[model samples]
Target: MLFVTIDRKSSVSLTQQIYDQIRKSILNRDLEEGERLASSRGLSAAIGVSRNVVLEAYERLIAEGYLEVRSKSGTFVAKGSFLPAKGKTSEYEKVMPNVADRKPIIDFRGSHPAMDQFPRKKWGQLTRDICYEAPDHIFGYAEPGGIRELRVTLAKYLQRVRSVHCHPEQIMITTGATQALRLITEMLIKARTGISVEDPVTDEMRNIFFSAGAGIIPVPVDENGIIPECLPKEEGTGFVFVIPSHQFPMGGILSIQRRVQLIQYARELNNYIVEDDYDSEFTYEGAPVPSIQGLDPERVIYVGTFSKILSPALRMGFVVLPTHLIETFRRLKWFHDRHTSSIDQLVLSRFIEEGYLDRHIRKMRRIYRKRREVLETAVRASFKNAKIIGRAAGMHLVVDIPDIDFDDALAGEIEKQGVRIYPVEHFAMNKGRHTHQVVMGYGSLTPEQILQGVTQLKKFLSTRG
Candidate 1:
């Protein structure tokens, strides 16, 4: 007879509880192979439960090969069901450090948009409308490049907003900019050739290329983005990856002179220029700069995403490939995941066609601009010597506090004081140059949170000083 106990108050069903205990006993070898189990009726009475519960449990166990039923005989433990228990502590658990349970009161990490402001109601309505009225073929596997409607809409929108020159047929939709980068890496990076990227770039960007078994030639960056003059003169370079619209961490706009130089260098090397037009939608100051791809579409591969504009949860982005790379990219994208969500692509197409995307960008620009102002004001007031770097664009600004090395230890200490800040040094490939600076993002924080978080940061720094 098997002894089983059931807690009537547990959220788990009685059937599951009975099934779990019997399975555990069999795996632990408490019930040896060929050992007979009590009849469903007898076990039901013994455990004071309905006979149906036991029968269901037994059926599940038998179906899973844990218990077998012989003709005219009772249920018996399966011959090969025994599995010895391993030690509780795993090898991974033994080596890895424990993560802290407490979350920072205010996190200043960049690249996150205001998720709370996501137009959920409108999005939901659009989704519902798309599902109801969209043709049945949309539910099936779509073109590996993307749906025709979305690519067409994006071609016009990119041309209008960012001055990108592209045909709808050349556009390939990706899960996000990350996927676009991965696919591009696969297509471009050869065994001998490597990529030339901005030094002090986002760590994620560096990791993507590095993980792809491609070498990275670190080109130094300044307040005006990648120094084109310092670009490697070698012939073994595959492509130059740059966030021209707004550089990460340092937050610089690549100057036109530098942009032209970058294009010429790529042409000289006979390589492509991977231009990541990240967060170009919200510029607080002068007119938005035109994309480098517009200057030389043949040599420049343009990558754009809706993650920063709307919500990262959407996982929607696109890449404009040069004419020659389109077919190869399509094959690569097909093998990667066949395609991104078709209904999502349709919904986004409608969103752009209906002009909701433009309106949302305008609204978020105002909100984010106000938050940026609040952050700048608070930081200036709190720390008189703090110098804000970068162009007056994007969601983040770099704060240069002289005489302070914003390394991991100091950042960790500040986190303990209920605030979190990212050190620019952490993003650097060459290190030590940006030890005095930190990147503070106001995209996800409200004006109130920005003000309070900066105040707390200043207070913590004062105590440390």
Candidate 2:
């Protein structure tokens, strides 16, 4: 007889507990490969959980290749099954992105948008009204791609604002950029593809590709954005992922000439270009550049998120697929959590349809532009050698420091002065090129706060002499 225990008091589900223990026994070699396990009914009777619960656990283990079902026979562990051997030493835990270091007086850490300027009142009303107006289907399992209403509205919106050309069928709403990238990575991996990414990208983005088992070729980016000439000449390179509209951290808009070259490069390589139009809404100096996707829609994958233009707390993002990849992308998206929040999608659809998004962007644009100006002015006043990088667009800019090592030690010193700043090297993959720079995000701070933060930074640098 099999002896199994259940903890009714535990927050962990009974199914999960059973799965974990059974998996542990296999990994510990306590349960031999091909050993027959108790039937779901027998296990339920022994442990006193519902038969269905035991069945669910067994199904999960079977799906994961831990167990197998034989016709007219009891369940048995899969033959030749082995879990990775446990390391003698415990593995290091991942560090949280923003480790709370006693709330600083001024925050210059990048990746924040102007939250105070969000039209909460209008948004709440839209949510309520849309819920009232949306059909019962909004609460049910959404259409695999998304609710048709949102997709249609976004199609029109992107075309009008970003010069993107896409049909409603080619657009898919995702939980966020993370999900979009995950699905895209899976698709590329299946195609036996290698991806070319901007060298100084966030570790979070890099990990996505690494997890998908895709080869990562880091291409160099100058002021003109990702240099087309530097892209991989090697075969089997499937795509180049770029934020050409507004390059992140070191915010350079890819030049028109470079955009043409990139499109031509993709055509020649027979590859795709993933355009992450992340922060194009807040460009202060010139009109926003049209998306590179417009130049060659057939070879480009355009992804956008409301997380930046709206509140980050809201996980709403969309991916515009090429016609060739739509079927595969849709099929994979359906299996990846079924659909995003239906209600949120419906509400966002109505919000865009009623022109609320345009109104909000216009309002926030003026506000963030001022913050950028305030930040740049302070930088000019404090450092004569401050080589301001990527100020033409985006909420944050990079200030390159020379003659001094601006590493963790200097960042710690700045943190001690009640200011938070992110070093550019923090985002670099191969490193060294961006070690002399730190990124300052102004979109989230007020004019007064920006001035004060810069003053503190300047004072700290003065003390270094």
* TM-score per candidate, chains pooled: 0.92, 0.77
How many clashes in each structure? 0, 0
Which model scores highest in TM-score? Answer: 1
The whole-model C-alpha lDDT of candidate 2 against the native structure comes to 0.85
RMSD in order of candidates: 2.6, 9.3
Please write out the lDDT profile of model 2 over residues 1-465, one tens digit for every residue.
235689999999999999988877876667888888998888899889899999998899899888899989889888767666766645443344345645656888676888888888988998888778878867788777888889999999999989999999999999899889989999876765688999787677889988988888988888778888888787687688899877876787789999898888888878888999888887777788899888888999999999888987779899999998988998888998888898888888888888888888888888887888888889988888888888566678898878656787788888889898888888877778987888899888999999999998889889878
- Model 1 spans with C-alpha error above 4 angstroms: 1-17, 24-36, 46-53, 68-73, 76-83, 92-100
Any runs in candidate 2 off by more than 4 Å, and if so which?
Answer: 1-105
lDDT of each: 0.92, 0.85
State the lDDT of candidate 1 residue by residue for 1-465, as single tens digits.
478999999999999999999998988888999999999999999989999999999999999999899999978998899997786989898887667855647989797899999999999999999999999999998999999999999999999999999999989999999999999998998645589999998999988998888999999999889998888887888899999988997889999989989888888889989999879999999889999999999999999999999989999989999999999999999999999999999999999999999999999989988999999999889888899999888889999999788999999898888888999989998988999999999999988889889988888888875
